[model samples]
Target: MTTSLRSTLDFLLYDWLQAESVTSRERFVDHSRDTFDAVLDICERIAREKYAPFNRTVDTQEPHFDGEKVTLPQCTHDAQKAYAASGMLSAAQDYDIGGMQLPYTVEAAANSFFAAASVSIGSGLLTVGNANLLMVHGTELQKKVFALNEFSGRFSGTMCLSEPQAGSSLSDVATRAVPDGEGFEADPLGPRYRLKGNKMWISAGEHELTDNIIHLVLAKIPGPDGKLVPGTKGISLFIVPKKLVDTEGNLTGVRNDVALAGLNHKLGWRGTTNTLLNFGEGKYPVGGEAGAVGYLVGQPGKGLHCMFHMMNEARIGVGMAATMLGLAGYYASLDYARNRPQGRPVQGPKAAAGAAPAVVKDAAQPQVRIIEHADVKRMLLAQKAYGEGALALNLYCARLVDEMHTGEAALADDARMLLEVLTPIAKSWPSEWCLEANSLAIQIHGGYGYTRDFPVEQYWRDNRLNMIHEGTHGIQAMDLLGRKVLMEGGRGLTLLASRINATIERAIQVPALAAHANALGAALQQVGAATKAAWATGQPADALANAVPYMQAFGHTVLAWIWLDVASAALASDADQAQPSTAGRMGAMRYFFHYELPKIGAWLQVVSSRDDTCAAFPEESF
Candidate 1:
C-alpha cells in the first residue's frame, strides 16, 4: 500500500492544529483545512506520478560524469520541474513575493510528501532553504535578482561551507574573497567580489537543470594588507553564481570561473550531484580575471551568523526527511506483513504433530500471514510509534517556526526559546530512531528485505545518510547539552519544561493518560536532575563525556511528552465516541511509555553521574 501523506496531513492540519486553533489569525487568513488539503493533494499527485516511479532508476543509474558534463536521468529533471511549477516552492513565503503565504506547518506537510516519494528528487529542499536565507538577509536587490528567481524556479541555489581542507570545521575555512575593482557591477544584487577558492561536497552544486546556480559561498575577506584573516570570524557570505546574470534576472551569458572538478559517488541520494568545484583555477576566467565573480551577502566577517539561519532550517528539514523515509518503509513493510504468509501460530495444534507438514506452494493448511504473529505485531507497533512520533515532533517544530513568525511578542519569544532547545533533538532523534524504524522495516521483510527486489533496503540506505546530515549524532548531542540547553541562562530549557509540564497537566486530566502522564512527570524530573548533575561536575570535559547519552535521555523525555500530547489530542477528538483510531493511538502511547520511557533512566543515570569512561580512555589503548 502507498503511504497516505494526505490522510496523515489532514489529521495533523485539521484534527490537531485546527482543533488547537493555532493558525487561525494573522498571515494565515483565508487559509483553511480545505486549502491546505488542496495543496497537499497536488503534492501527493505530483510526487506519486512524477517522482516515486523513478526512485530506483535514479538510485541505479545515479549521475554520471563524462569529464566535461554531468549526465542525469531525464526523469529527475521532469520531477523537479513539476515540483517547481507546483508553486509550493514559495508556499511559505509572503504573497508579495508570489508565495501562497501558507503557514510553515502546512508547507512542511506538503514537502513531506515529496521527501517520502523520492528524496533524490527532493533536492529542491536546499534551493528553498537557500532562498529563505536570502529572503531574510539579502539586500532588496539580492532578493529580486537571486531569491526571486529561485522562488520561481528559474534559478537553483546551494550552500557552500565545506572545502576540501576545512570539512565541518568552518573555523578553518581558507577560501578568500577579494574586493573587485574593474569587474564590479553597479547592479542591485549587492557588492561584487572576486572569489578564489575550491569547495567540496557541494550537493546540487553544478547542475544543468537550471539556467544558473546561485552559490551562497562562505569565504574570508582579506585584510587591507591583502592578508587572509583566520577563522570563521573573518568568514563572509558571497553570492557566486555558476553563470553570471544581469540585474533584470537575465543571464549575461558570461560563464563564471566555477568549474566542476569531479563528482563524488555515494551509497544513496545519488539523483542529486555531489561535486568538487574549483573556483579560480585560471580555467574559466571572466572579464579578463582569473577569479570567480561574486557578490557579498549581508555583511563581511559575519558569514557564519547569516548561514546559521539556513543551517538550522536545513537541520529541521533533515529530521522531516528522516521521518518520511521511516514512514514510507513502515507502510511498505506493513503491506508486506499483511499479505506475505510465512508461519502459523507456534502453539496452534502443534502442526498436527507432522514433520513441518511437507511445505507446499499451496498447502491445504495455508500458513497465516506474518502480521498475525505477536512479534511481528510488536515490530509494526514499534514502527508506528517511531514514525508517527517523529512526524509529530517535526510538525511541532514547524509550527513553532510559524508561531515565531506570527505570534505576539511574549508568545513568539517562548516559541523561539522552545525551538532553540528542541532543535538538536528535532534533528538528531529522528535521524537515529527513525533509521532504527527503517531497520525494523527491513527485518519485517525478512530475507527479501536484504535484496534489491525490496525498497526497504534502499530506505535504510537513504536514511543512514541523515545520521550524518547537517551534523553527526555526536555533534548534535554536544550542541544540545553544552550549548543550546545552557544558553540564555537556561531560559530555553525552562521554557521547554513549562511546555512539557503543560502537556503533562493536560494528560493528567484524562484518566486513560494519567498513568503515562505520571511516568512522564517522573522522567522529566530525572532529566532535570541529570541536567543539574551534568553541569555541576565543573569539569567541562567530564560533563560532556556522556553528552550523547544525555541527548538520548533528553530526546526520549521530549518524545514521551509529545506522545502524551498526541494521546490527549487523539482522545480529545473521540472523547465520547471511543473510536478504534483513538484506541490505536492510545495503545501506541502506552507502548512508548512502557517500552521506551524506561530506557531513559539508565541513560540519564550515566549522564548525571558524569561518567568519563570514554573521555579518560587513552586512544592508544584501543
Candidate 2:
C-alpha cells in the first residue's frame, strides 16, 4: 500500500539513511539499508516507550544536590544505563572498542532521536563522546590512565573552559597552574598541586551519576619572565580527576580541590546538572606546600587546538540535538493537528438550523482539522523544511568527515576544507532555525503550548539551550566571516560557491526546478560579489557586520539546492511503489520553490547592503 506523502518523505530522508555513504559522493549511505532500518526502529521504540515516558517527570523533578551528594531521578539513570547497554554510546567507534562501528552520519541521525527523547539524558553521552575524542588525540599514557578508565565507569568526564571572569574569551582566563612538590596537594589522592579558581556553567560538574569526574581543565602557565603569558598561547590543558588515581589507575576515595559552589537554575535543560565549581580552597591545597595535581594533555600553548578536537564534534552534536527537538515539535504538532478539530473555514457560511449539513456525515467538514488550515500548514511546512534540511546538512557533513579519513588525497583534502568552512554554519543555522521551528510548534498548539500539558513547550526550552551550546550565534557568525570565509584567501567561500553553482547548473536542466535554480543562482552571484567587495575593503569589522546575513542567505540557497537535488533523485526513482512517494516529493519541492525560495531575494538584499546602518549607531546611542 502507498503511504502518505509525509510518511514517504520521512522514510526516504531518514529511514533509508542515505547520508552515510562515503565511497562515492553520489553513493553516500548506499549500503546496509537493513542495518539502518533496524537502528532507526530501535531508536523510535526506545524514544516512544522509554525516554518520552519520563521526560515530564525528569523535568519536574530536576536533579537536586544535598551537602554531601547530588541526586537524580532513577529513570534518568535507567535511561543512561539502557543507552550504554544498547551499545549506542560507542556507535561511532571502531568495532574493537565495543562499538557497532556505525558511520558518523548514522550515529548523528540516531542521536537526534535520543536528544528529542530527553536532552538532559542525551547530554551525558555527548560529554562522554567529547571525552572519547580527546582520548583519540591524547598520548597513550593519558588515554590509558584517564580515558580508558573513564570509559570503563571508573571516571566520568567534563569540559571546563568557562570561568566566572572569562565566559567566551579565553584570553581573559585567570586560572593558574603552578608546579609543586613531586605532583601537587590539591589532588584528592594527595601529591597534586592546588588549583585555585572559580569555574562557572560546568555541565555534569558534580554528580553522583559517576564515581569520579575527569575535568579537561584549561589553565595558564608562567612564561619566560615569571609572568603569565598573554592569550590562549600560554594556556594548557590538564586532565584533573575528581578522585586521585595511582600509577596503576586505581581510584582512591574522597574528592579533589574542586567543589560545587552552587547550582544554576536555568530556564531550560533542568534535567542536566549545571554547576559553579570552586577549585582550590584553603583546606584543600592552596599555599599548603603542594600545587594542584595535574597532567598536561598535549604540549603547553597548543591547548585550544587540542580542545577543538572535542569542540568541533560538540558543535555538530549541538546542531543534531537542535534539529531533533525541532523534529519532535513538528511531529507532535502534526499529531495534534490531525486529532484536534477547530473553528470553521472562513470560506464557508454558517449552517442553517435543521437543514442537512452540506458536508457528508463521514466526509470533510467546512470546519476542517487544524492541520488543513492554511496558516497552520505554513508553520508545519516551515518546520519541516528547516528540520529536515538541517538533518540533511549534518549528515552531509558527517559523510565529509568519513571522506576526509578514508577517501583519496584530493577528495579527502577537499572534504576537510569544505567541512571546516561549513562547520559554523552547520552548527549555527540549524541551532537558530530549528529553534524557530520549536517556537512555531508552540504557536501551533496555541494556549496549550504555553503550559506543561504538551511536549512542544519542553522541546522549545531544550532547544533554547542549543543557541548557547557549542557557541553563540554571534560567535559562529564571526568565525564564518572573520576566519572561515575570509582566511586562506577566501578559498572556502570560493569552493562552496562552486559547489552551489554545480547544483544550480544541474537543477536548471530539470524543468520542474529551473525557476528555483535561476533564483538561487542570482542570489549566489549577489552573495559572491558582496563577499569579494567586503574582502577587498580589508575592514574585517565592517565585513563581519554583514556576516549574519551572508550565513542566512547562503544557508537558504544551499537548502533550496538540496531540495532540488532530492526532487531530481525522487523523480528518477523506479515507478513501481515509489511513484506516489516521488509525487509527494515533487509537491514539496514545488511548495519550497513557491513559498520558501522567494525569500532569497530579501536575504540577498540584506547581505549586499553596506554596514552603514549598523555602524551609524554607537554604543552610547543604544
Model 1, 499-572: lDDT tens digits are 88999888898888899999999999999999899989577787789999999999999999988898888878
Per-candidate TM-score against the hidden true structure: 0.95, 0.89
Query: Which stretches in model 1 have alpha-carbon errors above 4 Å?
Result: 1-3, 19-23, 182-187, 348-365, 576-578
Query: Whose lDDT is greatest here?
Result: 1
Model 1, C-alpha of 370: deviation from truth (Å):
0.5
Supply the TM-score for candidate 1.
0.95
> lDDT per model, in order?
0.87, 0.72
Candidate 1 C-alpha error for residue 64, in Å: 1.3
**Residue 44 of model 1, lDDT score:** 85
Q: Candidate 2: what lDDT?
A: 0.72
